[model samples]
Target: MAPSPPPPAASDAQYAQQFLNTVLSQRGPSALPYAEDVKWLIRNHLVALIDAFPSLRPRVALFNHKDGRAAHLLQADGTIPITHAGAVYNLPAVLWLPEPYPRAPPLVFLSPTPDMLIKPHHPLVDCSGLVAGAPYLRSWVFPSSNLLDLARSLSHLFGLDPPLFTRSNPPNPLPAAPSSSMLPAPSPRAPSEVVYSPRPYRFPASPQLAARPPPTEDPAEVFRRNAIAKLVDTAYAEAAALRATREAEANALFAVQAELRGRGEWVDIGVRKIAEEMEALECRLQDVTMATDVIKAWVTENHKGAADADDAEAEGAIQPADVLSRQMLDCTAADLALEDAIYALDKAVQEGSVPFDGYLRSMRALAREQFFQRVLCTKVNSAQQQAHVTRMAARAPSHYAS
Candidate 1:
């Protein structure tokens, strides 16, 4: 016998409450006026994060900072690689909660180890080592935005192509200007300051810098370029947002379809519909093939008859017979093409490769083609009959006169 299944885990709310209780017991109550509410929000958000990403649960830590305020630190779960430019970084990060909780977004900072080096090139990242940017922090809205959203946004940013400046070495520094002789000599620097030689800081070079005209002292052109850059960035951000939304919607639709397929009735209904479509397509294909065969046989007989007549007639009369044969052959070819298309569609339906709606569409298109071909054949037959009647009438008048 198979082992019994484990019981369902606690609900998210229940887990959050338990975690909140544990944290309060270990660290003592928050000194803030709305301590319970803040703690509840933090616990709920953290629980949501862990639920979304189970691997993060073991690496996540909550503690009180030196200021006696609560903070959360989440170590990289190993699943998500932190890469910038061409280099992969390993930096655990801290989340500093605001005193007002949901009213303001939390501050995020990279907790780099002794050997880790991180360049500040990301728009959200600052020289002071804080990660505060729009959509996650700066443009955060209460009730709609949460910690998990922030984490997701940050994860997405890390996956993008890192800023160019971060991938390139710092530009060579210009030589120092000649010291003024009038000024007194400066005192020697301390050993600590002298030993630590920081790279000269410069603004990140934009990818389009080469395309842009050389730097001008004109304020108007500078403002224009800045405006253009902002517009481009905004458009890119919107496009990314739209793409993410579409992907999420598509995933949700697939999940729903999978769930529906699990039910016996749904599966039976879908199979029945598919079978009916395949039968219809097969019937239509047979009709088209028969029509094409009839046209081919008629064309072959007409060609033989025309060739015999052409041998007996004058050379000028042979041209008309040949033209008629060519037209008949063209018609036969068209019918055969339509027949082939229907056959392919039938095969696809039988193999279950085509969706029901697609199958229906193919059937409709084939039906239209078949109808048009029938109309053309009928017109050709009517014209031939009229011509035969006209020739007989002309001959009958001549015979009566004789």
Candidate 2:
């Protein structure tokens, strides 16, 4: 069974009350070390920092000043997210704010556990876990620099050179790290995930012992091999992520390609069907010419006198009434229809819906038919009019000549 978690903290109002009480406790030598005004600034900065990185929690710790002064100070402790070699890893660290903070840079330290080892020769951190030379710390401007920016800068620097690494082979029967109030107590139901406690804790390193056993390998070799293995794992993970992205893109392209191919096939089928219809229409040309000749003959017979008119005109079929002269009108209409059809073909060519060669051939055939229809209509109309005038003139002279 897992160790049970610690109890939750006070409510917002209660926490505020607790903070006020702690900061205002200035009655004795062991009272809160920060001034009244400095306490307000610290609260504001800390509140702002937590808002940005909720993983860090605020607490009090014994701060060892450079002048050998040990004063109780506010500490922000937890892991910060760092991206290194295309991988994100949590870096457990602590941020210590001195009483003169904002006027002075805050202190930073790597909080390594027993299973972890401090990296050697890091440009920013030392063996004692103290951090220095950070760009933000060295150039900190008073009244403007805050804990949030400090944490962000340190996170960036640490990512480039991680200050801690896990041991490849930890010693057996390890002693537990000393418990401090700086870390949140684990809950029995809590999952094994890094929790950014609003307030977390501190730890104790292995106690100094006179007769400790030696390690099997040099510390340097063990750390070096661990570093190499971690790098290999990070590279593999990044490559796998890239490969997944590429495969998704390829699948999308193939789907588009399939849809386009289906559309192309449908277009090809439509064109072939239109071409077959055109061929069938061309085969009916002889029948259309015969019908035209029959219409012309019927018109010529209708103009004859009553004695010469045919008594056997077709029965129960629709015939032209006085609404219009049907023979000439119909012939002109067919000619105009062919002309309009050729115009449509011209548009189809311009739109590139039909091939240029097919457009040209179809237009020529239609234009020839229109020309012949117009000529035949003109001849029939002229004859009908002349015959009407001749009859009228002959009747006009008979009354006077008698």
Off by over 4 Å in 2: 1-30, 66-68, 173-402
lDDT of 1 at 123: 70
> Across residues 1-402, which tens digit of lDDT does each residue of candidate 1 receive?
111112236653444345444543344332322355566666667667656643233122343344555333322221223453344533345454545666667656653322223555667565544575534565565566787777766665643422222223334544433322211112232221111012221222223212335344467755764575466458656765776687689999999988876786777988999999999999999999999999999999899989878877864453435444556556666878898988898999999999889999989988798778767776776776777787787878666757
> Over all chains combined, what TM-score does candidate 1 have?
0.32
Q: Give residue 39's error in model 1 in angstroms.
A: 3.5
| TM-score of structure candidate 2 | 0.40
Candidates in order, TM-scores: namely: 0.32, 0.40
Off by over 4 Å in 1: 1-17, 24-34, 54-90, 161-402
Range of the 10 consecutive residues with the lowest summed lDDT in candidate 2: 181-190
Residue pairs with backbone overlap in model 2: 5-186, 5-187, 5-188, 57-198, 182-200, 182-201, 182-202, 183-200, 183-201
Model 1 is weakest, by summed lDDT over 10 consecutive residues, at 189-198
lDDT of each: 0.53, 0.66
- The alpha-carbon lDDT assigned to residue 308 of candidate 1 equals 79
